[model samples]
Target chain A: MPAIEVEGLTVRYGDLVAVDRLDLRAEAGRILALLGPNGAGKTSTVETLEGYRRRAGGKVAVLGLDPARDHAALTRRVGVMLQRGGVYPGMGPAEALSLWAAFYPRPLDPAGLLERVGLSAVTRTPWRRLSGGEQQRLSLALALVGRPEVVFLDEPTAGVDVKGRQVIRSVIAELRDEGVCVVLTTHQLEEVERLADRVVIVDRGRVVADGTPAELVTRGAGRSIRFGAPAGIDVAGLAARLGAPVNEVDPGEYEVGAAASPATVAALTAWLAERDLPLADLRAGRERLEDVFLRLTATGGAGDGGQR
Target chain B: MSSSPAASARQPGATPPSAARQLTRALAAQTAAEARLTLRRGESVLLTLAIPVGLLVFFSVVHVLPLPAGVRRPVQFLAPGILALAVMSTAMVSLGIATGFERQYLVLKRLGSTPLGRPTLLAAKTLAVLAVEVLQVAVLSGVALALGWRPGGDPAAALGAVLLATAAFSGIGLTMAGTLRAEVTLAAANGLYLILLLVGGMVFPLSHLPGALADVARALPSAALSGALHASLTGGGPGGGVESWAVLAGWAVLAPVVAAFTFRWE
Candidate 1:
């Protein structure tokens, strides 16, 4: 069975439906990245899976057991790293980690986990005294100490520094290598590209797109060639010769929306030569994940456009 | 990389210990950590330990209030009352306020999501409160003994009363902590502590109050605890009336049950 599964999941807060009929599955030895704009039900879905919030409808199973009814048994097999407020303000990292480790049947050594997270030198520092990056690193360490079969991380690198982010990435990779199912939600598209094996994008409490990074980038708005030339070129004439839609996105910047085959390149070169329009620069590119994300999520606001 | 046994032991498939063993260890660790934190806070120390000892010594040495018909010494009337107050402050006021803030900061919510069950967490907290009460009893008894105070009643009865008082107060405290906001719990706990001190016959005898108020005071858990302690400590043979035990027992059973049902983790 898949390590984690959800079917027809629905979550509502009074009159507001935070997550509506969502389905997700993650197998062992894989990373499933949940990406979405703010207020798109990413947190609500993850929280339901973790058994922190009650489900309004449908089924959610982790390790083949109901998360809510079998919470104690499920907790032993799964780990969760929240967005904030898990550690005591005045407690040191060693104390907090060791306290959490006691709850597990067999746990990683608190000291060793701290060193692995690059927090050995500051283990004695109180949680409130640690920097934001250090706190994030410690939180990650606590989540891993349980040696869980499945782990859910929300915004794992939100405030982490470059070195801290690298450590987290390596740790996540190691967990995946060990056949531990991992599900993470993050806004860093670059991190998603580097770490995710499967991507599920949510918008307005529904899955808008779900695929691998390569598949998502190549699926819609296929291969294109962009060039910089003089403004006001013959757009209608170029369309007839190339048999593709050409758009002048900006002044002097033109895009040809079609595969750049040898014949197409040669034809375009001849056409430009005939007009004596000097092509300053030209490169073939595919649609970026960020571009797709923005196009799918943008309604009117820049970033705050989603059901909350 | 596999040269060291420690490295091999750190592998992912290391077999877990029994669940019972893990729960036991978690409870011990949580209790110790809670006790250590309570001891470290200067304000909590003042409320739980210092104030009770201070009252015991000051009342034993001075004659500030008029003596009742049978009471010859002020300490005879004050020691048991102070002991009851100690339990109320530690188990009710201090525990409730601390737990309320812990919930507010999401500490309880985080722990609740872990392998440690809610019942285990509550057990750990109760154990921590008892550990601190041990220290409070020792210091208060020592002060009272130094001032020539002697127990004239059954030691077993006194022990039972203290335990019952602890349970009754802790139940109410956890109820407040679980149901109310942190700031609101803080204010309400302090307010109840003061009110009980005045009317529950902790610093003064219930007889000093007017007729109706005196009857009400006698029915409260605080007054019940004080009356039981006084009877056992002063050779009065469980001086508390039947209504006092019934009141204390009722609170001990009802408050925790209500809290378990109504408590919010976050």
Candidate 2:
């Protein structure tokens, strides 16, 4: 059975429907990244799964128990790192981690967890005095201290510096390798690309696209050829010759889609040579995750049913 | 790092600790942390400990208020009242305001999502309040004794009064903390503390007040606490007035129920 299952889940704040009917699942030993813009209901959906917010309608289960009804039992198996404000401002990171560790039956050693999160240097510094990146790392440590079977992290690397981000990335990778189920929400597309095994993109209270990163980029928008050329080039001439949709995205950068084949490439080179239009650079690749996300979310309603 | 028990504990077939053991450890850890936080805050110390002790000393040395007909000295008369005031401040005002800010900061929201259940969290907070009150009582009693105050009542009766007052005040405090904004709770708690300090018959006798206000004071939990403590400490009997005990008992039951129903973590 999956570690977490949400079917037809809906959450509303009075007249405002924060999360519309949504279905999601995560199995043990995999990392599922929930990506969305601000106010797209990513927090509402995650909070519902964590049992912090009540669901207006539908089912949400963590480790086979209803999150809302079985919160006391479910919390033991799942750990959560909220976006902000969990640690006491005056308490040092060491103290905070030790206290949180004690909440679990077989918790990680506080000192070791602190060192693992790269917070050993600031172990004695009060939470209020720590930098934002340090605070995020400490929060992550608190979540991992519980030896949770499943973990949910919201914006885990929001303000983290490069080194701190690496520490968090490695820790999350370790959690996945240990056969633990990991679910996280982040706006950092690069982080998602690096860490997430599966990506679920939610927009305006609904899941717009859900699949592996490669599947999303490849399927959402097919392969394209991008190159830089002189502005105001006769893109109509190129389109007539190539017999495919081509547009100049910027003043100098142009993109050719649906005609990225070798024959099209040769034809385009021949066409450019015939017209003496210099191709400053040329690259052929599938769409990046960022491009796919922007297109899917910017279009509002589920554009393509890439659900898996 | 791989040899760490935390790593081994995650392996399949490893036995998870029993639920009862987890609960017990969580409760203890939370209580200790809560107490440490309360003690570390300068404002909490000033309000809960300093102000009460200062009042006890000042009132004991200076005969500022007129005493009742049979009271021999002001120290003897004011000691028990100050004790009640200390209980009110620590359990109600201090706990209420601190909890309000904790909620505002989402500290409670975070902890509420953990394996430590709400009931257990409440129990840990109550335990922390009691722990602070223990120190408050010890320091205040020592000061009172230094100023020539003697207790004439059953020790058990005074102990019972302290426990009841803690319950009544903590319940009311938690109700305020759980329902209102941090700033609002701060203002409301301090306002109630001051009102009770003067009209609840802590420094002044309720008999000295006009008939209508005195009756109102008699019904309040603060006055009930002071009256019960007075009867136990000075009157040398378990009869701190059945009515006062009844009022306190009613508050002790009702306030917690109301708080539990209305409390929000964030």
Give the B-chain TM-score of model 2. Answer: 0.92
lDDT of 2 by residue, B1-266 (tens): 35544466455554766878878888999999999999998988999889988888887778788776678788888888898999999899989998998898888988877778888988999999999889988998899998999988766887887888888888889899998999999999999999988877788788888999888888899998888998888874222588888988888888888988898878
**Which lDDT tens digits does candidate 2 get at residues A18-66?**
8989999998999999998899899999999888889999888899998
The docking category that best describes candidate 1 is acceptable
Please give the C-alpha DockQ score of model 1: 0.43
Candidate 2 docking band: medium
Question: Which pairs of residues have clashing backbones in candidate 1?
Answer: none
- Which one is best on lDDT? 2
- Tell me the DockQ of each model, to 2 decimals: 0.43, 0.53
Clashing pairs in 2: none
Model 2 C-alpha lDDT versus the unseen true structure: 0.86
Root-mean-square deviation (CA) per prediction: 3.9, 2.7
> Who wins the TM-score comparison?
2
Kindly list the per-residue Cα lDDT of model 1 for residues B1-266, writing each as its tens digit: 23222234456575667777878999999999888888877878999988888877887787896544588877778888898999999999989988988998788877877888888888888899999989888888888777777777777977888888888888788889999999999999999998888887777788788999988887778988988888777877323666777787787788777877888888
